[model samples]
Target chain A: MKYSGWNILKQALTGKKEWAPVWHKPEPKSHYETIVIGGGGHGLATAYYLTTEYGMKNIAVLEKSHLGSGNVGRNTTIIRSNYLLPGNEPFYELSMKLWENLEQTLNYNAMVSQRGVVNLFHSDAQRDSFVRRGNAMCIAGADAVLLDERGIRNLCPFLDYENSRFPIKGGLLQPRGGTVRHDAVAWGYARGSDSLGVDIIENCEVTGFIIKEGRCVGVETARGNISANKIAVCVAGSSGRLMGKAGIRLPIESHVLQAFVSEGLKPILPNVITFGAGHFYISQSDKGGLVFGGDIDGYNTYAQRGNLPIVEDVCAAGVAIMPMIGRSRLLRMWGGLVDMSMDGSPFIDKTRIEGLYFNGGWCYGGFKATPASGFCYAHLLAKDEPHPVAAEFRLDRFKRGHMIDEKGAGAQPNLH
Target chain B: MIINHPLLGPRDASEFIYLGDASLIDRPDWNSENAAQQFYEYLYLRDNPAGTIRELWFHEYGDRSWLVVTRNTLTHEIVNVELARDIDREEKHSR
Candidate 1:
């Protein structure tokens, strides 16, 4: 059903009984041309693009649990393309462009707010790096603005600009970067894909791959064995175990990254502000809650809950930049499993095995890269070639010594 | 998470530095024919299991010792902690 202002008024004038469900829940068929594992935003968006762009009708997106139960619903929802690396800046800028018209394309209100993002720099060296990143972003066709101390203060006056330690000197602002309602992305993509004859099978966990004669033929799921010509895996944090089952060990580690939301208060934060002195970024939701997050827990684990040490550390960083955040009441916190890649980037490429593709290792940037990750992944699966923007994200890049070390951190999953 | 140190009774996990899977301690022999591939696997690949796992943790703040910690990843329960130096010496002796 095409939803618009006219549809709402018509449904209101009638009894509202003619309105249909967003997407139909259907049983899985015996086989499909392509099978996508995991029903998160990326997986659903992959299926959506495969059908919409490539015109592949027979596709299925299998989810272990309910849709949007993974990182899609657990992120702080900030989106940006402010990157310095050639491999990263273009890909993220593609995602940012897709996000601009996502709600209109999906015909669902994703609540994409372009309130802008500011990465505050505390030192001259940090400012230099931000300048380099801003230049790279502009080269990649994304907008960037270098804001001095006064410019930053004009935007956010409540910051601790004169702190003795970690003083805020300036900032790099991307006017296009902002937040989106994370779960709505999943729903919109799911509904759009389902409308195009794509099967979105929820609660269907894939147990193992059917690799016959060294080529993936199908998958063994909780429901039944379903065959497919092509199988694309985009299960985020579960990438390690799933690919390991297929006899492939990825250069990825599963770590829990926590996110927090403070109790709802009147609007205080003007926009998303990131602390360059520390690993903390915060933004105020439309509902008036301050949503924020920091570094991942420095361990390899699949746990969805974090300890108090990280909570205390994140809150301390919050207080360092904006001292007023200490007055806000702590509401709740949660963790999502992130597939931390070796060089802090993502992969969207085919494996050595024919007809078997993989898409993961997004680390902390999966939520923001949802649309382009899916689109580029679809392009790869359809054309069997990497997208121009995502060409550097090959699994063999590490073996070939072409690692896109965006942070310049050498082969450290936790540091990335 | 409270990791019980072998020397000190109990220490908070915050005092320790997480070094990932304990399999890292069993470093592959450098003189082997597939030394390059083995080292690559040892450094990059991980088991990343969901249940009980043996891991390496350095007590950076308290005892200044690198300890092997056996814990459940899902439940975050510490099962055992032993001095990593002792384990290294034992591996050397067995070799």
Candidate 2:
């Protein structure tokens, strides 16, 4: 296997082996260290990092539903740092690094395949955008190679070369990015963090917060109340509804994102291919089946399942773009609710509320940022200081007008 | 191969997301407003009763791009669904 910078960076991060005091009975134990809400990959990874990297094991991860049942498990499992924003690029690159060595760090097989992903540019403007993004990634010491038709064809042969409106020009290939088993990742972090003594409270929903003297004293879960000195909200889909209860108005929209799978076939797609023009993305799984997803449902909906139009739409794009795939029949489809932020970027910064931190609004790219988000958020929560990786996601940026809106299309995908 | 989606209207005028073999017309920086009309006319805009409407025309104002539509060749009926835009567009002719 060819080693990339992603492999080098993955060697840098570490996880904890210690655990915080568990609270089986709901009650404030004097002043526990930290309380992380939303026990998905973000929450679990945050706990593991805080305990390992920060030596702060006095932490608890509270999950409303079962772990890995949220957006973390709902993602298509693509991990790449091919971002265009200056502020956002390095952070996701850091995420890419962490993903490179995730198997060893977690001591679990995440099934991470760095088969490579190419963002095809069909126009001059698109090429220009790729140039800027590639330069940025290169500056950050990440791989972002520009490939021509020959290169693209060598990567994916079954694509249609003729009879298409937008003929192929070239693409941006990020060798560091690829795919992973989404659910196994969540479980690996949970098992790793649990071994370290971090409490993984499943089916424990945070109904509200206990605030005294303008500071969050504890959380009110379905089981009851528990006190902590600090708290972090890492939930994605239900982030809005959860924050609303605390009177916190976040610029987050609950958007439904979905994915589809084709019945098992002799593997054809070699790597992940994303269309820069339309909301099209696809990759062949190890099971010899095609797995893919696209733009989030623009509407705000709690519906775990979407309508029939999108399934047909995504598969249509798949078949239209690649003629060889026309015969592959779609097998199953699913939905995931994501916290679509106003800037199309995440908010991994301290909130206005005292002792409150947030790690959400990852949009469609959260899975790619799993390790980086966890490591950075752990640094912030444990030391009460922001890490370099997540400094760009500061809440003040929104206030300071220095927001890192890479798409320049604002928050909406239709607009972006 | 020909089917009508409930959400997407029948044939040309109907705004449906296409989950079939189609491509975006190669145009330089076409505005979103014109891109929709141009894309429809280029790949999807067709007769009252035609073959499977392989290309898409999603009404982005609502439900966003998850909607997919196709027209039946014989009955002129429409078949549509909310699909993940997992399809890859043929970029060779897209520009």
Model 1: per-residue Cα lDDT over B62-88, one tens digit each: 879999998887888888889999999
**Model 2, range A298-332, lDDT digits (tens) per residue?**
54455666656666667766766787878778888
Chain A TM-score for each of the predictions: 0.99, 0.91
Candidate 1 residue-wise lDDT, A186-212, digit = tens:
999998998898999989999999998
Candidate 2 ranges with C-alpha deviation above 4 Å? A1-31, A411-414, B1-95
Highest lDDT scorer: 1
How does candidate 2 score on lDDT? Answer: 0.72
Highest TM-score against the true fold, candidate: 1
How well does each candidate superpose onto the true structure, as a TM-score?
0.98, 0.77
Q: Chain A of candidate 2: what's the TM-score?
A: 0.91
Best by DockQ: 1
TM-scores of chain B alone in all candidate structures, in the order given:
0.93, 0.34
Q: What are the clashing pairs of model 1?
A: none
